[model samples]
Target: MPTSQAIQVDNLSKRYGKDVQALAQVSFEVGRGELFGLIGPDGAGKTTLIRILATLLLADEGQATVNGWEVRKNYRKIRSHIGYMPGRFSLYQDLSVEENLRFFATIFGSTIEENYELIRDIYVQLEPFRERKAGKLSGGMKQKLALCCALIHKPVVLLLDEPTTGVDPVSRQEFWEMLQRLKEKDIAILVSTPYMDEASLCDRVALIQKGRLLSIDQPGKIVSAFDKPLLAIRTNDMYRLIHDLRAFEPGHSAFPFGEYVHLSLRQPIWPEAIHAYLAGKEHTGIEIKPAQATIEDAFMELMTREVM
Candidate 1:
C-alpha cells in the first residue's frame, strides 16, 4: 500500500492442470518509476506472472497488487490503472494505426487529446503510416503502434511481456530507448524478456527459470556475484571440448559462449594443468584465456545448478 512500491507480489504461485507448476512461492516488488526486468527463458513463468499483474489471469496462490489494489479482488480497478502489452500482437489487424489507437482510447474512456503527450514520442514514428492497416506494417512499426496503444491511456503501471521479441536489432534498440524515456514519467514498468543483453538496461532484474527465481539484483551485481575465475577455452576439436572439460575433476562449470567455452574450476588451479590435459588428448589449436562473467554466464550457472 506504500506509494514507493507500486507493484508487490508476495509468495505467488500458479499451476496448469495437475503437474505443470507455472509459478512457485514467487515474490518481489517494483518501486515507482523503477524499470524492472523479469529475465528468463521461455516457459519460465514470465508471461504467467505478467498476466496476473495485468489482471488477465488469476494466481493459484498468494497475492499481487498493482497501485495498491489487489489484482484478483480489484481486477476491474487494476485493469484501468495498468497498461499491458502482450508478447504477441493482439491489436486489430484490419484497423489502421490511428484507428487502433483510437479504439483502445475509447475502451479506456479516454480521448487521444487527453493523453497526447504521454505517447507522442512513440506515436510519431507510426504517424507516417497512420492510414496503413496494422497487418501491413513492418514488425518494428507494429511494435511502435502497440506501444502507442498501451500508453495512450496514461496508466500508472506498464506491464510489457517481451516487447522486443522478434523485433529487428535497430528496432529493439529504439524500443529500449523509448522505455528509458518513459521511465522518467514515474510509471512503474515491469518488462519480461529472455535476452540477457537487455538486462543491463533495467534498474534491476529478476533472473528466473522453471517457475523459480535464481537471483534478483542489479545486472552489475549479478555479474559480480560470479566469483569464480573464468577462462575462455576453444580448440580445433570444439565438439569434444565440452566433454573433456566436464570430465575434468577440477571443472566446476563449462558453458558455450559464442566462439569460446567459458570454464570455471572448483579449486584454484594453474592454466598449465588445463593445457596439459587438453594436449594429452591430442586436441590441436587449443586456446584458453581469462574471461569476464556476464549475465548469461550467471543465469547459465544457476540454471545448471538447479538441474544438477
Candidate 2:
C-alpha cells in the first residue's frame, strides 16, 4: 500500500488582519518520509503556514493533519513528534551551544545522549565550539546548532523555514548535505525557501505567491511546463540592449538575467535583427544565445500569466 501522508492540508487559510491574507485556501499533501518544499519569495505566507503546522499559530479556516493527528485538536501530540527550525535564530543567545541543545532536549522530556544518533553528524560540527555562546557563533555555526537542538528529540517530521538563508555558500551546501543524510532515516521534511536553485533538491515542491498556491509538481516537471521560447542576449551596451529588445516586438518581455537579458519573443525574431539593432546603435560584439527555462523563469510566468 502507498505510504500514508505525513502531513495533509486542505483548503487551509490564514489572515493577519483585514488587509493581509497570509494564506488563501492552500492545499497539498506531504508523503511520509518525503522532502517537500514550499518555494516562494518573501511575504508569500510560507512562514505563516509553517507556524500553523508547528502549532505556534492557528489557521483561520480549513483543516490540517500531521501524522494523522488533527492540528487544531491534537497539537499536544503532534508537537511531540515534530522538529521545528524557524527562519530566524531563536535560541538563547546567552547560552552556550551545548547548553541550548541540552535545554531543548530537556523540554521534550529527553536527553542529548538519548537521541545523540539523530543529531550526531550535525552536532559533531558544533562539538568543537560547544562552549561558545550561541550569540557568538557564526551564521553557519548557529544554523548547525539550531538544527541539532531541533532534532535532539528524534522527531519524525522536520520543518525547516529558510534554514540556509544568510549563510555562506559553503555552509549552505553543507546544510543541504546534512538534510539529504537525514532523509535516509525516513524523516519527513518540509522546508521553505526563496532560492529557486534549491527547489530541485526536493522530491516535490509547491510554488506559492501572494498567499496563494501557484503550482505543485516535481522540479523537472515544473520546468517542463514552461512553454515559452527564451533567448539570452548580451552586448557591450547592456542598458541599450534591454530597451531595444523590449521595443523589438509589440508583445515581447525582456529583462536582465545576470550578464544577459532573457527575452520572451512575441513571435519568431531573427538573430540578425537583434545583431542589426545593436550594431546600428554602435553596440559591439553583441552575442545572442538560446536559453533554457529555469524554476525562476517558470515562477515569473506563473505569477504574471493571470495579469497579462
Candidate 3:
C-alpha cells in the first residue's frame, strides 16, 4: 500500500454460495481527503464492496486496507477510525435526536460536548428537534441526524452507502454541499449512488456493473473516451422511431433518452444521409442533432460492448 492512499483494494472478490459473484477482481485507491464515487445501478456490487471495506462483511479473495489497517485483522481499529452509514437508516429510531447523538458518543467513550465542533454545522440544524424521536423525523432530517452521529467520533474516513437515495432534489443538493465541507477536513470519503448525474460530483469514479468494473477515471475522461459519433433524434412517434432506428442495418445502437432517442452509428456519416433515411421511412415531425456523451451514455455504451 502507498503512504498517500487512504484506502486500497486489490483483486477483491466475493460470492454468495457457489454461483453469485458479488465482486470480481475490483481494485481501486483513494487518497487522503479525496472524494471517490462508486457509480453503478442496483445489484452492481456497490454495497458489497463498501461493506467489505467497513469490515462488516469479509471478501472471499484478495485484500483491502483502510487508513493503513488490514480490514480482516484490524477490524477493531478500522471500526474506530471509520464512520459508516449504511444505505438504510440504521440509527435508533425510537430514541430522540439528542438521545441518539448522546448514545453513539457514549458507545465511543466520548461525549457530545467533547466533540461538539465536529458536528456543529449539522447538529445545529437538529437542535430545535432535539427532543423529537428519530422515527418521527422526515427523510431529510433523519439523514442529517445519521450523519451527525457518524461524525461524532471524528473518524478519519467516511463510508456512505447511497446516502441520497430517498432524498428530494433540494435536500440532495444540500447533502452534497455538506460532503464538500467534510472533504475539506482531509477525511477520505467513499460514497455510492445509482444516479448517473451524481458521478460528476466526485473527484474520480469507478463505473461498475454486474459485479465487474468497466472503467475507472475522471467523469470527463470517461465521456471523452466514447469514440463513436452519436446523434439525438426526436420524432412524433417515439415507439415507431426506435423500431425503425434499431432495424437500420448501419446503426450500432439506439436507446430512448429523456425526450429523444440516442443513436450511435457504426461509422461516421453525414447528417444528410440520416435525414434522407428517416425521410424515406415517412417519419413526421423529425428532429436530429449531434449529442454530447454523458456519464450515462458512456455506461450504456460500455454495457452494450460487454453484452456483445
Model 1: lDDT to the true structure:
0.92
Per-residue lDDT of 221 in model 2 = 99
Which is superior by lDDT, 1 or 2? 1
TM-score of 1: 0.96
User: lDDT per model, in order?
Assistant: 0.92, 0.90, 0.92
Cα misplacement distance, residue 75 of candidate 3 (Å): 0.6
What lDDT score is found at residue 279 in candidate 1? 98
Give the TM-scores of the predictions, in the order they appear: 0.96, 0.95, 0.96
lDDT of 3 at 21: 94
Per-residue CA lDDT of candidate 2, range 76-140, in tens?
A: 99999999999989999999999999999999999999999989998888899989999999999
Q: Write the per-residue lDDT of candidate 3 for residues 85-194, one digit (tens) a residue.
A: 99999999999999999999999888999989888888888999999999999999899899989988888999999999989988888888888889999989999999
CA error at residue 34 for candidate 2, angstroms: 1.0
Q: What's the number of clashes in each of the models?
A: 0, 0, 0
TM-score of 2: 0.95
Error of 3 at 303 (Å): 1.3
